[model samples]
Target chain A: EIARAAAALLRKVKGPVGPLAGRKVLITAGPTHEPIDPVRYIANRSSGKQGYAIAAAAAAAGAEVTLVSGPVSLADPDGVTVVRVESAREMLTAVEAALPADVAIMAAAVADWRMAEDAAQKIKKDGSGKPPTLQFAENPDILATLGHHAALRPRLLVGFAAETQNVLDNAASKLTRKNADWIVANDVSPATGIMGGDRNTVHLVSRDGVEDWPDLAKGEVATRLVERIAFALGARDA
Target chain B: EIARAAAALLRKVKGPVGPLAGRKVLITAGPTHEPIDPVRYIANRSSGKQGYAIAAAAAAAGAEVTLVSGPVSLADPDGVTVVRVESAREMLTAVEAALPADVAIMAAAVADWRMAEDAAQKIKKDGSGKPPTLQFAENPDILATLGHHAALRPRLLVGFAAETQNVLDNAASKLTRKNADWIVANDVSPATGIMGGDRNTVHLVSRDGVEDWPDLAKGEVATRLVERIAFALGARDA
Candidate 1:
């Protein structure tokens, strides 16, 4: 009995299959839209393929995953609970509702700003030939908010830095600024063909150092990321 | 013989059901992406549904349509030739290639700027945690270029004004600036539900004046616009 107990503890600490069994993971994916109006919105070029892949991998790893997704054309992954939303504000609310998880990954490309004041009616053209000025309001930073939340914060907080330049430095800064344990940074320059593409090259940024990852399919990246998360959390239930 | 000749000319003026038969229409739709690097890009929220609707309507009206589209999830409309592109430069090139048309509609939300300098390799984080500064270069104005083209300019140069305020004024200004014959101005304020929504409210601004149109589905709008184009061209073939 003593040997068996020791072996079980070792399995909990070391890498083990089904390490994330009974673990609750929270993930956000897709592009958060900022409404310019009821029919129009401010959005990004995120296909949500990466985030969706991660959610599926987490589920496959035996985690109960809640994916807070923005509007996209993808079908929901099997064995995961999905909360669909349109705007950044709605995404934030949905994320907050799925809190108190073992891990929280902020992977969605949330719009930075939204129209400060949306017109009530369809704006009409006046006689003058000048353009109207648009005022903007900053959107909520979901990763930062949940990372530094006073309560209901996840045990492990991870964020993503999808940048064109300064991938590592930007991701490292995001780790500190967002109070995240790790950041998965990827370059999205057009030449790389990663944006809206299936393959990605990633760099894992943490306090210790940055680990460069080779280019792989988004699905493979997701599996590796899930493995890392499981190793970090140990074989423990949330 | 004289009466038959007169009727033949009259058929040319009236929409013979397929008024646009053999007429080539060039259109640009969706949001143009501006790449920051190999994997990241700067883009906007444009569903490409409006443009697709226009293409479908144009095809239904017996016009040979070439749609220059950006990255969007929606499938290609039947009977339309779609030329898919990623960045603003690619879109501009594609638009130029599909020229010499009777009507040209610039409907894509082209990105204004792109990273002036893109890193050839994935940037790594040094000891310093500062983010890299990004410089921008302006993208070519597709509407202005085609509208003001010395040659190969479409008989009906139509441009869309997606504005938040001063809808009429901005649209009128766009007509003069872009040298377009007509401007279809629409307000994208959030309450209007015209942005990604199927319905739209438009103001047709021409040299005569602004004609305010009530909210209608994109398909209806397309039908009306095609009718107007047919009337303007007198059933002429390009």
Candidate 2:
């Protein structure tokens, strides 16, 4: 028994002992900036707190984590390999490069549109009262692309849906449309203060059913989610 | 001699000492966010570092500083009253409310335009590949409005022009058009690393001519600018 206890302590001390040992976890975080010019861009209100917490939790679980993050003020999580990018296209490239993982979590709030013809110089006022019309182009859907990548797609794919209305319905639809195994949905209404807040109340939507989670600190949510992921992967292996 | 030394020490320790003692200075900093929807907004690359440094310097120089700042990650400077705003219109209102100052420095990268009618909800991508056309409306010119305010126009009005090209020419034209006493211009090209970098090489433009400042840390620039403002105010008084 003493020998077994010593071995367990050694396992905890050394690398790759947890349930996620030897597994690869890939995650995307932050808001993608879609440039309109050299100086300006369009961005969302994602603070990247939840995703960063999840990354940290995964790394703590002894997973070989690769995080593809956009421009965020967050520091790199301990024991995680981070690849930083600015725009959605760059993020997609980075994510693709870090793929072939056991789990892929799409948590970044990717911009849907970008300037079709970004101005070379600052767009100046022509002294006319009228403002210039802006032309936008649709950005590549990163989650959908990963979901459709049959050969290299992660064994368990997760996506996030931040909606103001019909949160569960939107999340369920997203799960099917994106071919993701689970959708973490949250109401990001301005009144909710969830976009940049530390605490979140997320609902887990899967093919089986929806699990409404209580309001919890983002770190707690991450820990619970990571635990669930380990169980799911164990079941899959069994 | 002992009494004189004691008086000097007291002055140094007391409130409102230095060149700008008993002066009121109003400054604006950071980039304004123009909302397109609840989730996304257009923003510039202004880090608010330069402006925040200036506010700190002004406060250290014994000026009663009112800093009208936009959304920035920076903490409020010591002894400075900071009014936080998000959009250009809100910034204008805040600046106007903190008016009738001895000096005004417009350093914020205020958006020239905002959405004509921002959406109440997050915009979703349709099945079509095309993106929706966006309409913009011009924002109020805070600097120009203050310059044109004859009754409460500051004794020394300053503005900043962050340009990628035609830096000097744009600054010179802006000095005259905005009726500002000086224009602090800098090349914010990505190559220069000035937009969000610590070091800056700025040119001070005025009716007299341009003064090319050496590349200096942002804090040093702020100190020098505050000294110049004090000198200018003294000269005006003389």
Candidate 3:
């Protein structure tokens, strides 16, 4: 009953609030697979929950949201136009297609390196004397590319810095290298279940400074993020 | 087979890399659930992934890791000592207990408010003509408390800021307010997925400046973070 009332109140409040009604938001989610063979590929565990949640929040805030997602099984969020892609290259293409958005959030766990050349067929292991050496090459830095773009660059270009030590120092360096307006940093060791779990704790960094928040649910984070975006755009207009 | 080989190579290369060894590292994770009733409480979705990952990485780097976790189901990482708590108060107690460490990472998403009094029994929904007003009181600022501790303060005190707009500005304010050595910042909007997902993107902020990183797997972030921590500690030692 309380939840229902709160939801009703929210609807009432949102009816008159079009903070981002005409804004276009582009988001990337999940892990891009770097294929080594027809059947096998290198991929990380990224559930796309964060990206999906952001899409929902952006739409709720009245933004026209385009979600460029990697291969994930999650359902498409309401009011969000989702574009699915397989590899980093495909994701980049999709992002390019969704250009001129007001905000571009690069949330996908893009593989930094991919197999130099994908194998036509899967190699069979017959107790080979030596293992095959799979050559790799660095993939495009999507955030940096978009951030440094002369055109089609969103007003706000945000990147993620997942660091373990000197977290601040490394994030600061990245801010300049990527030329991003903002960066979010967190530590993601295996024991924390950050990669596959349902909750997160993070920090926000930018030119102005840093702010630390109490750990909260992803949903809460999404809602708060939307609120902030709305406030930021509104302040700009004012 | 490929994974095993990579692990072997990593082990061989890691032996000569002493970065955080002989360091006493402390970390906090998850959300503190402040109970209003036995079955009801205010809690956030802080799975403690970032903090746990930090602990694991520190341990992997040969540091003595003490993890003070909130209510979470995650098992303790290998070679890590885990201290579990249920509420902000408990979390504070646990953190204090593991103090005088070389570094302290505050990653728990702790609730900022708690019911003044926990109801012994669930509030009956007698369809009371009006909902009962529950009084809330402020919870302790764990980050600030530790960051400003007069004695046994860690050499490095890291805090997280989950913000939406004016991210850098707000983070900067927090750096001063909390007296934190560093702050990790993120939008935490549903789109970014820093919360309960397997992947994350973030920014690092501090007195020196900001650094941003490209989107990568949470594990990759952890590995990179560990490397930074090792380097920073080594530099300090030297």
Candidate 4:
């Protein structure tokens, strides 16, 4: 009986595990809503699908996953611990809290510009026919910050670039400027229906070279991305 | 009066003109369905957005656009021609009839598999309750055929891939296999929400190398793509 118990325990321990076993992965998703007023704010159509999928994929690959998501309606994926935030500052704080991950994927559609000063209350449309002149400011580049961290940075830091013209040239510039390991570039023109669609087509840009892929369902992309992450991690460990 | 008439003639002769010039581009969107019976057929949720958007973007960029789509009922983008179809064979014919374009982009989600023999009538349920077996055959690769013509291929050949793992590695393989100039790759696990949602993240792969981009609105992506295409064409001419 004792021997049988020991064998069962060993089997449990030796079972096939995911590639990300013992690894930690951090992901950020959705668009931060910068409050312009108590009832209104600036936001985009980021649904947090890609980020959530990455977190789920990492977890399935046997990693400890932390998902820092913006104000999205999606439920937390199974096997992932989710931290929710509304503003860019809050998202940064949440990301900092989920530190020391093996990989950090910044898939969030962060707003580059925000209101200079959020109004405490909604401003009424005055009889003055002129439109209101609102001041704006630049938001921190989260991907750059995380990617260029001298210490406590993840082994792999990935960023995204959404471009229209000079796609490759601009993406290359961003990759070098941001110090990211990889950058996924795509043409999200309103005509592509990628902003909130179930299918997507993208390009992968790395220091080595550029690789293009066929259009695919989103689910398939996540599974593939997780597998690649695993292989990349394995190579790094070796 | 004679001098003015001569000047007008010269201006008319010098004006830029091409087969695709000022003509609307109409595209068939997404994969097709070839039914075997009332309840059975082969289908994929391709979400007609990519091709449809291309049509719209092309139109927006100055070409008149028409979209002969499948069953998807997405709102007709402003200023486009839309025709709906149901089968690959139908799509092919539609495409042929719509040709003589200045530029045609084949971005539809074409099926690569179809029922070997579609039954004219529905098969009745058997007394044994055994499910009817399905036999499938390979469907045509529409993009390759249309984009690889010795004389009729589009000026630009673009293909899409929804890969689950080793995306770039596999994308590189497909680029050669398909004899295409560009491939768009997307990681499409269920979590990516790229198929039915409002936002997308993607990568652009090509021969030169990889270039990654940040996430942006789909409309922005389209506008940028049009701008890039224009720039590329201008550079080619120069």
Which portions of model 1 show Cα errors greater than 4 Å? A1-21, A31-45, A60-62, A84-97, A109-153, A159-192, A200-217, A224-238, B1-17, B36-42, B111-139, B235-238
| Candidate 2 C-alpha lDDT tens digits along A1-238 | 9987886688778856777888999999999998888899999999999999999999888899999999899999998999999999999999999989999999999998889888988887778878988889888889999999968989999999999888998899999999999999999989999999999999999999999999999999999999999999999999
Number of clashes in model 1? 20
By TM-score, the best candidate is 2
In the order shown, the candidates' Cα RMSDs to the true structure are 8.7, 2.8, 24.1, 26.0
Write the residue-wise lDDT of candidate 2 on B103-179 in tens digits. Answer: 99999999999999999988877668789888899999999999899799999999999998999998998888889
The TM-scores, one per candidate, come to 0.71, 0.95, 0.48, 0.48
Off by over 4 Å in 2: A1-15, B1-15
Better of 1 and 4 by TM-score: 1
Error of 2 at A211 (Å): 1.1
Tens-digit lDDT string for candidate 3 (B1-238): 9986886587577642246767888888886777655334555545677778878887877788898888666779888999888889888888888888888888777766666787764343233333355565677789999888998878888887765456677778889889998887766554567666677677788899988867766667667777876677668878
**How is the predicted docking of candidate 3 categorized under the CAPRI scheme?**
incorrect
Rank ordering of all candidates by TM-score, starting from the highest:
2, 1, 4, 3
- Candidate 4: tens digits of C-alpha lDDT, residues A1-238: 9986775576479742568888888999876877654333555556677778778888777788899999676789988999999878888888888888898888887766566787654333343433345565666778888877788778988877665445677678778978988887766555677666777677788999998868987666677777878899889989
The model with the greater lDDT, 2 or 3, is 2
Q: What alpha-carbon RMSD in Å does predicted model 2 have with respect to the real structure? A: 2.8
Residue-wise C-alpha lDDT for candidate 4, range B26-134, written one tens digit per residue: 4567657666443234445467776667766776566666676765647888767777788787777777777655445555666555567876543433434344555
TM-score, second chain, candidate 1: 0.88
TM-score of 2: 0.95
Q: Which stretches of candidate 4 lie over 4 Å from their true place?
A: A1-16, B1-238
Model 1: per-residue Cα lDDT over A1-238, one tens digit each? 9986886686578633365877899999998766544334455668899999999999878788999999788899998999999888899999999988989989898765666776554333343533344466667789989988998778889899888787788998899988999999998766778877899999999999999999999999999999999988874433
* Candidate 1: residue A188 Cα off by (Å): 5.1
Best by lDDT: 2
Interface RMSD, per-candidate values to 1 decimal? 7.4, 1.0, 26.0, 27.2
